[model samples]
Each structure stands twice: as structure tokens, then as C-alpha cells.
Target: MKEKIKIGMIGLGGRGMGLLRLVILNMSDVEVVALCDRYEDRQTKAADKVEEKQGSRPFVTIDYQEVLSIDEIDAVIISTSWADHIDIAIASMEAGKYVATEVGGAYSVQECWRLVEAYERTKIPCMILENCCYGRDELMVLNMVKQGLFGEIVHCAGGYQHDLRDEIAYGYENRHYRLDNYINRNCENYPTHEIGPIARILDINRGNRMVSLVSMASKAKGMKEYIKNEKSHDSELAKLDFMQGDIVTTIIKCAHGETITITLDTTLPRYYSRGFTVRGTKGMYTEENQSVYIDGSHDHYQSWNKNWGNAEEFREKYEHPIWSKFLEEGVQGGHGGADWLVLADFFESVKKGTQTPLDVYDMASWMCISTLSEDSIAMGGHPIAIPDFTNGKWITRQ
Candidate 1:
């Protein structure tokens, strides 16, 4: 029988709570041991839910270090703010705990470097929980690419675009930091979700890494408008430091001659879209308008629907037998229930003492865009270099 992986959770905020709920509901092979939150109120509230789910009260604390003090913990689920992810991740890694960080992983380049160093130094796993990688449509696209069905996928475009100012002005309790995260950084600052899964399908950093990125932005329209019409007092608006109406665009180059475009906009109207397009040597597969195009012999192309990224049908026709053996793993969830899928992978990897499919190197590759884009934006759209966290060893190590 496989050993149960004891989990310690840090930051019981909204997203953290959602993931906690997911683990309680979906992951049967794990045990929730510790829960931490800086806000006492949130800690108390979430503890009740945690007790209800686990049928036993967890070791709860307002101090994160207290959660880390649990020597019995085998791993930790970090759902802290973007700014805090790196610090907690490194600390947990140093503490001999497998660390799974919330999306976007780290905020700064230095923090990313630290995360890689911690993994290399400790040999314990560090993962960026880019749940989108497990999403059904995303995974189906990846499976097709791997089968050489889509041929040599060349170019891809994706993003995490949304209107977040409302969440800032009047969204939810405990949303101040999250709302601030949106307006402070360029829109595409968080691009891992839309890119991670597709890139995996195409085997990007697995073979080649992004070399450079050039980021540019437009005016900040939404911020300016909101401030202009805020309230009768308007004092709060004047005090805020904002450059509204900006649309950040980042163009990336992969060493394998593939290119990707990422766009970010929060000072505008909102709609979130994730793209799946594989322009291969013989044909094209797209998640756009819900269709796939296969090259034809005589100017007439074969179009496919329900074949491109149909998670249900793809699951039925999946060529990978391993995905089937783990069928009961990710029962019901989003990203084709990828959150559960990847977590399942983590558990299995831990049990077998094997390398995680998305390893430390994958974490670095996955996080490069946001880090570089920030620099590119800081330099007024100057090109920035991506540090090969693999230390000159380009592709897979060990």
C-alpha cells in the first residue's frame, strides 16, 4: 500500500481555501495535517471547514513558521500571496518538505533563482501548481501534439486577461492584495495558466527554452476613468498612484524557432480566453471557433471538430495507457480536472521516489515569462534574457 502524504497548508485565503477544498474532496490518499493563516479571523473560519472535512481539527496557526514546525509533515501546499510564494517555498524546501506553490510561483527573478537553488541543494521537489496544465482541453491538445498527429507545432499565443479593477474597488473581502496584484503588474504578468499546458503539449522547455521577451504596453484607460468619476469626496482617488488604461503585450522567442505572444489588460473591459493552436508541418489544430484543420491533397482541407480539444472524447481515445490506469485519480474538477491530475502525479511521484513530470526545471521554465516580462516592461520594452535555471544544461537533466 502507498504511504499517505501528510500535507501542511499555508494561507487559507480564497484560492487557498478552494485548493484545500479540492484536496479534501478529490485527493483520497493524502492527509491534511496543518493549516496556517496570518489573519486570525480567516484562520478561525477556515479551521472550522478544515475540521468538518477532515473529521478532526487541524494544527492551525496565524504564524506560518508554526505550520512548518510540524516535523511529521511530508509536504506543504502554499497558497500565499504572489509576493510571499517564494519565501515560503524556499523555507519549506529547506525544512525538508515538498512544496507546491500557488500559480505564478514567484514574484521576482531573485526569488525564482532561490527556488531553483533550494531544489538543487535539498533534492526535495518544488512545483508551481499551474493547474491549467491539467485542464482536459489543454491535456488533450498536448496528447495530440505528442502523437505527432499535429506534426511540428510552430507558433502559439495565450494569456490570462481579465478585468480586475472591480475586484479592487468593490469585489470581496480579503481581496485587497489580489486586486492590487492585477493593477500593479502588466496584464500578461500571469501567463503560466494559458501557456504551461500548451507548451507541454508542444514539448517546449522540455527541448528548448524561451531566450528573450520584448514587452510593450498601452495607456492605462480604466484606472484614469475610475479615478475621474470615483465619488463626491474623490479624495481616495487622488491619493492612489495609478496609470490607468494600459494594455501590456509581450512577445517571446523560443530557441527552437517557435514564437509566442501574450497580452495583459486590466484597465479595460474583460473576457478571459485560453488559446490552443498547433501549426504543424502537415496541418493545423486549433481551439479557436472550435475546429481543427488537416492539410489537404488538393487545396481542400479536412476540418475536425470534437477532435481538437474535446476532453471527453480525448479521454476515450487517449493513446497513453498510463492516463487510464490513474482514471479514478482526478475524478471531477476543472482544467479537465487537471488540479487533481497533477496532484495525483505528485502523490505518485512521492510514493515511487521518481522525478516529477513537471520537475524543478519545469517550474523554472514555467515561471520565466512573468519574471522577464516584468523586466522588459521596466525597461520600456527592451528585450530581456531568460536565465537557464538548468545552469547551461539546456534540456532535461538526469
Candidate 2:
């Protein structure tokens, strides 16, 4: 029998609690041995869930360092707020534990470098828990690209297009972190969700690297307008100033002759989507419409008939091996079963002592987008070079 990989969980907010619940439900190979959060209430809640699911309460504490100090924990899942990710991940790695951290862009390029250096110094595996890489549709597109359907990729466009006015404006209700971030930061704060999959498809930090990027932001009017119209005209948020733009668009150029456009549209009023769009010499795929178009696959005039081929058909044919296995057995948790897979991969990598699929270099490169974009935006959309956290090794780092 495979040995159980003892685990510690930090930060018991919604995202953290959601992942802890996923591990309890789906990951029998993992043992939730420790639970930590800054709040006693969250710690109690997580401890209760662990006991209810596993029939035993974990070692609970309000301090994350206590969880890290435990000797039995083989790995830790850091689901802290955006500003705290790098610090927690580096600490976990330095404590001789593998780490799986939640998705969010880094606050500064220096912090990203610190994360990279921590992994380098410790030789500990660290994965950014980019659950979107396990999304069924996203994986199917990746498989098709691997199979040469989207030949010689030219460009891709994606975004966090969710309408998050209420969530950001009401951050105080649940002690959520977005309110202050939106009020102060002027970058794509949550970029890893869309960029993670795109980076894999683009083979960033493997064969290609992001060369430079430019960013622009619309005026910060959405939250104030939303508060006045939705909450109250005289609400305190309506009188406060916000730095985040209603929509921030960034364009990235890759070393291997590819360009990516990332649009951050969360603060606005729009239907939720990642807007996964891939264009190549031979074909194109768009997640918003759930359709794909290949050159010469359809009649030239038929393309104008609004009946593009459905993505479901492609999913049936080319579901990723991971999703295929889950479909045959079962799938659980949020993000269309992605959360469970992300945790499963983390646990499995820990058990096997193998390099995580979303390794440290990918973590640094993907997370640094926010800081780099911030610089670009502040410089009036001037280009900013993305650091190669792989240390000149991406050219041969397969």
C-alpha cells in the first residue's frame, strides 16, 4: 500500500476551506494532519471538517508556523491571501515540506525571485495550485494542440472576465482580501487562472519564455458606480478612491514568436468567463462560444452559417488522460472537477517524491505577471521585460 502523505493546510478562508474539503472528500492518500489559520473561528471550522470527514481532529492552530514546524507533514497547501502566498510557500519549502499554493500573481518581481531561490536552495518541489490547468475544456484544447490541430500557434487571448462587483465591494463581510487589493493595487492581481494553461500551451519556462509585456487600464469607475446603484448611493465605498481599473488589458510577447493578450475585466458588469481564445496557423479555439474553427475543415461559406463545430464533440474525442480517468471513476469539487485533480496531483507528487507538474519555475513565471504588468501600466503602457526565473535554463529545461 502507498504510504499516506501527511498534509498541513494554511489559511481557512473560502478558497482554502474549499480545497481542504476537496482533500477530505477525494484524497484518501492524503492525511490532513494539521490545520492553521490566523482566525480561531476558521481554525475551528477546518478542524471540524477534518474530524467529520476523517473521524479525527487534526492539530489545529492559529499560527501557520506551528503547522510548518510539525515533523510528520510531508507537504503543505498554502491557500492564503494573494499578498501572503510567496512568504508562506517559501517558508513551507524551507521547512522541508513540499508546497502547493493557490493561484494569484505576485506582488513584486523580487518576491517572485525569492520564491525561486527558496526552491533552489532547498531542492523542495513547489507547485502553484493552478486548478485551471485541470479544466476539462482547457485540457482538451491542450491535447488538441499537442496533436497538431492548432498548428504553429500564433497568438492567444484570455482573461478573468467575471463580474465581481459585489464580491470585491463586500470583502469585509467574510474578511475576504479583494476589497483592499482593488482599492490599492493597479494590476492583474488574479492572473494565474487564465495564464497557467496558456503558459503550458505556450511551453513557457520549458522551451519558451515571455520576452516583454505592455499593459493599460480603464478608469476605476465600476466599483463606485456599482456600489451606488446596487448597494447604496451613500455607501462608504462610493466615497472612497480605488486604484484598480474597471478593465486592465495586458499584451505579452513570447520569445518563440507568439503574443498573448490578457484582459482583466472582473470589476465590470459582464457574464463570467476566462475568454480562452487560441489562434494558430491552422485553427482557432474560443471558450466563450465553446467552438473551434479549423482551416479547410468546414466549407468556406458554412463558416458564415453560425454553426461552428461544438467543443463537446472534441471533448468526447480528446479528453485529457487525467480527466478521462476521473470521468471513469468519479469527479468531485469545484471548477468543474478541477480542484480535486489539482489536490490529487499535489498529493501524488508528494507520495512519489517527484517533481510537481506545476513546478517552481512555472510558479515564479506565472505569478510575476502582476508585478511586471504593474510596472508596465505605471510606465504608460511601456514594455517591461519578464524575468526568466528559470535562470537562463528555459532554452533547454524540458
Alpha carbon lDDT of each predicted model: 0.69, 0.88
TM-score of each candidate? 0.87, 0.97
In Å, residue 263's CA in model 2 sits off its true spot by 0.8
**Tens-digit lDDT string for candidate 2 (1-398):** 24888889898899888877765445677789998899999999889988998888899988899999999899998888989999999999999999999988888999999999999999999999998999988899999999999899999989999998889888988799999999999998888888989998999988999989999999998998888888785467778989999899999999998999998998887899999999999988998788888788855565443755477778777888888999998878887898888878878888889999999999998889999999988989999999889889999988
The local distance difference test score of model 2 is: 0.88
Off by over 4 Å in 2: 303-305
Winning model by TM-score:
2
The regions of model 1 sitting more than 4 angstroms off are 171-173, 226-235, 238-245, 297-330, 334-336, 396-398
